[model samples]
Target chain A: MPMTTAEKILAAHCGRDEVRPGEIVMADLDLALANDITAPLAIEEFRRSGAVKVRDPRRIVFVCDHFTPNKDIRSAEQVRLIRDFSREQGIENFFDVGEMGIEHALLPEKGLVLPGDLVIGADSHTCTYGALGAFATGVGSTDLAGAMLSGRAWFKVPVSMLFNYRGRPGEWTGGKDFILHTIGRIGVSGALYAAMEFAGPAIHALSMDDRFSMANMSIEAGAKTGIFPVDEKVEEYVRGRSGRRGRSFPADEGAEYAARFDFDVSGLEPQVALPSLPSNVRPVGEVKGVRVDQVVIGSCTNGRLEDLRAAARVLQGRKVARGVRVIIFPATQRIYLEAMREGLLEIFIEAGAAVSTPTCGPCLGGHMGILAEGERAVATTNRNFVGRMGHPRSEVYLAGPYVAAASAVAGEIIHPARVAGGDRPGEEN
Target chain B: MKIQGRAWKFGDDVDTDAIIAARYLNPTDPAELGACLMEDIRPGFACEDVRGGIIVAGANFGCGSSREHAPVAIRGAGVRAVVAESFARIFFRNAFNTGLPIFESADAAKGIVEGDEIEIDASEGLIRNLSRNETYRSQPVPPFMRELIASGGLLSYMMKNLNQEGKKK
Candidate 1:
């Protein structure tokens, strides 16, 4: 049988020759995970299964970072439920609020996952681990509970889409924009039920940070898992950060791919996903005249320190446009502290940007940064589906941190090049 | 059992957020969820004349996020099965869990174009694309999953199996 990168990964993990899409393959799970928000519910379901002990306590990982530091009574209660469950179940990989970062960031950092592994988590971005060459994806509390009880998951192999990124990115354009452009071309469900493997010269040239960002948003294209072939960069990342070096699994040179995408990165400009859809994209120049009421820079997407620095470099010594609210939330507390140590926080405060604690807020419209009716905002987070950030009537434009910061200062859709020294003297107004 | 349906073709990498947007995260009703099916990902999707048919795609279908609503909404929107080049892991299980059959053929989807009336034989991996009068072989579903799907999802299958076991005991 002709094998694709996805088939290679799944076959490597499950010890299979060929597996079809929609056919159930019961395979051992490398890791099963849930965070505070989903962990409690998983625990409840696990207990309801009438099992005296968890199937494999060591395989289960629980983290508390969604509403970390006890933002409210409910959040605190949720944390405690996970804590008690971990202690009772003897789960060795449980991490508390302060000890945990974002669930997606912390798991890979802990050396708990390896290349060619199959993983499942309770969060949608569980596909984030595919950056390490694993076929990881997300599930709900009920499904996770089943995995917790059995240490096994049933899966149907997905179709594989090979994203062949070519050419070097233009100056000031980042990984976020590349994905935004991919979504623009593919629409929303372009890679539905398929594995997206990032290959080619351009993708290989990207730093690990950039690779993570690329793999992270594959979910946005409606892919099952997005992956990169494990190489020295992955080995070095695991060794340097997690104290473990995983086996590398590069796709065979002649491997089959269902759909092949060749993207040229040259001449690409800062892009945005207009309100209610990631694929509803346009060049930043087209929406330059649009005004904004809010500018948010953070989320699983573009909330890392690099993203903060990019936004900071643009906002330095510049005050936010009057009546335009700029909110920045780092992805994790470590990123928050790192930014503070480097005085990025001060630059944000001085520039009139409201910096909030690390949380999945405004991104989910759960707590902070909820929008009112008829409001408009530009954000660096992934996804801007209707009512995603708050009110259904509120519009959201998705961009990278630099563009997000520039929009905050201009109080509308402004390109980062205009503010970040990329534009010619008389080119942009 | 063999099931027949029309084929609706797509390219690849259809993420869950596109199946059901993030804005509808809190909704639990499958029917209400059906109303918003692929509205954002593919506008006018519901009005696109899809009925009891299979969605054929290139590769990496249902990639982003592990929201089961993606498959549930698609099935609820009158899709009986999805035959794709591949599927996202979560969506694969979610589809079967809800009794929606999915077929895999990297080239199976390629052979049949849009508006192809096809007969799917899941057990044998046989598909007859009536539009092109072509017979293609797809990846066959495992025997165990076929039973679960035939009995209408994992929960219902398990309920019937457990009840039988109880009677035997």
Candidate 2:
């Protein structure tokens, strides 16, 4: 039987072939993880299993990325609990803020993940690893608790949604806009319980980082996992990063996809998701001239050095609007250090953007960049659900880093390509 | 193993936050949980209906957050079985490990309306829609999962069996 990338991964992991959608499969987990935010509950549930020792401590990684810098006493206590648990459990793979970055970036950049592995994390963006051909997805704290206890979790194979993107993106359009536009068309929860397989020329031309950005937002559309077939681009990235090489796996020719969508990338533009939902999106041009109170260019969604550099390039020698507080937090410490080393930090600071430490700060309202009642902010984070970051009355506008940076300068939603700068307006620089 | 009850149905994408939002993550009250299940997304899903029956849902049911509270809330609200066209990867396993019977029927939510009487044969993973006079086959419960539910849950089963082995020594 012809199998999609998802089916191939699940089958290989579970030691089965031709697994049916909606059928429970006892797949082996390649990697399991929890972070400070979810680790406390997971540890509690692990203890409830009554096991004197973890099934395999080495397989687990504990990251302190969500509320880094000890935002509050409660957060500090939570981090302390995780530290104690790691030390007590003898899990030396513990990563505190100093050593950690965003959970998804830290994992792959550190060579902890490889192709065809089935990994799980406590954060929804865990699906980001699928860019490298892994079937990685998120779980709740309790489900993570169960995995830590038993080392395995059950699954119902999902149906598949195949997205075919052809041609290149329009000027000023980046990976962020691609995903936003796709979600806008499909709506939030459109790919519910289905694996999204991204294929076609446009997808093939995208860099590994771009693909990572694409797969990362699958959960926003409620997909089980988003995947891409392993190819030379992925192989080159992984091999260069870790000095590790692995074979690529593409779907067998003519693999069956439950549903397919074809898009012309050149027609797409910078997209923005309005408040309260990821699906509430419109072309950036349509929403242009709208004002913003703050601009956040961070989170696991778009906090890499390239992403920061993209924003920095837009903000250089420009001042943020008087009332706009622009904050830029890199996804991981490594990315932050890289940005600093590359002098992007200087540009950000000179542009009057607050360059916070690496953490999931303000992404989930854990710390930093939170808005008050009737407040509004433009963010590069994933979800803009009501009360997600702070007060229920606060609204978050989701946009690409470039657009966010431009808006930080204009104090309204504007295309960075449109700004008077080095790159041409709407240029694919 | 057999599970018989009335039925409660939900649509797709019943997220973790909806099952139990992040604000209430710290609580231990499962009873209080039943009231809030689907409160944000489905408003009245857990309260007015969904008593003493199976839950049938469309594709991608229980898709978001892996909070086991979702299944806990369902079971706590007196649900016996969850029948869905498909389930999110983690939620699927969480239900079984916690002793909540979840069955998958491709026609999962078809013709099985809100107030249907249903009987589930866990051994065969079959659902008999008594109200619709239709019988459907579900995804088979694996052997280990059967043992888990039979022993009342993963923790209980492990405690009883493993602790007994210690006494045998």
Best by DockQ: 2
Q: Kindly give the stretch of ten consecutive residues in candidate 1 chain B with the minimal lDDT sum.
A: B153-162
Q: State fnat for each of the candidate structures.
A: 0.27, 0.20
What's the C-alpha lDDT at position B127 in model 2? Answer: 84
> Which residue runs does candidate 1 get wrong by more than 4 Å?
A17-23, A67-76, A423-429, B1-92, B95-144, B149-169
Worst 10 residues of 2 chain A by lDDT: A420-429
Assess candidate 1 and give its lDDT: 0.76
Give the alpha carbon lDDT tens digit for every residue of A1-429 in model 1.
Answer: 667666766776677776655555767787899877667656765665565577788789987766666657767887888888888889889888556766776677678887777888888888888888888887766667777776766666777888888886666678888889998999767876678888888776776666667777887877778988887777777775544445556666676677899899877777889976788888777775789999998877778888999999999999999999989987777888999999999999999998987667677666678789899889888878666677757788899888899888888888777766764322353
Candidate 2's fnat? 0.20
TM-score of 2: 0.82
Cα displacement (angstroms), candidate 1, residue A64, comes to 3.2
**CA shift at A281, candidate 1, in angstroms?**
1.6
User: What's the lDDT for residue A340 in model 1?
Assistant: 98
lDDT for B6 in candidate 1 is: 83
Candidate achieving the largest lDDT: 2
Residue A30's lDDT in candidate 2: 70
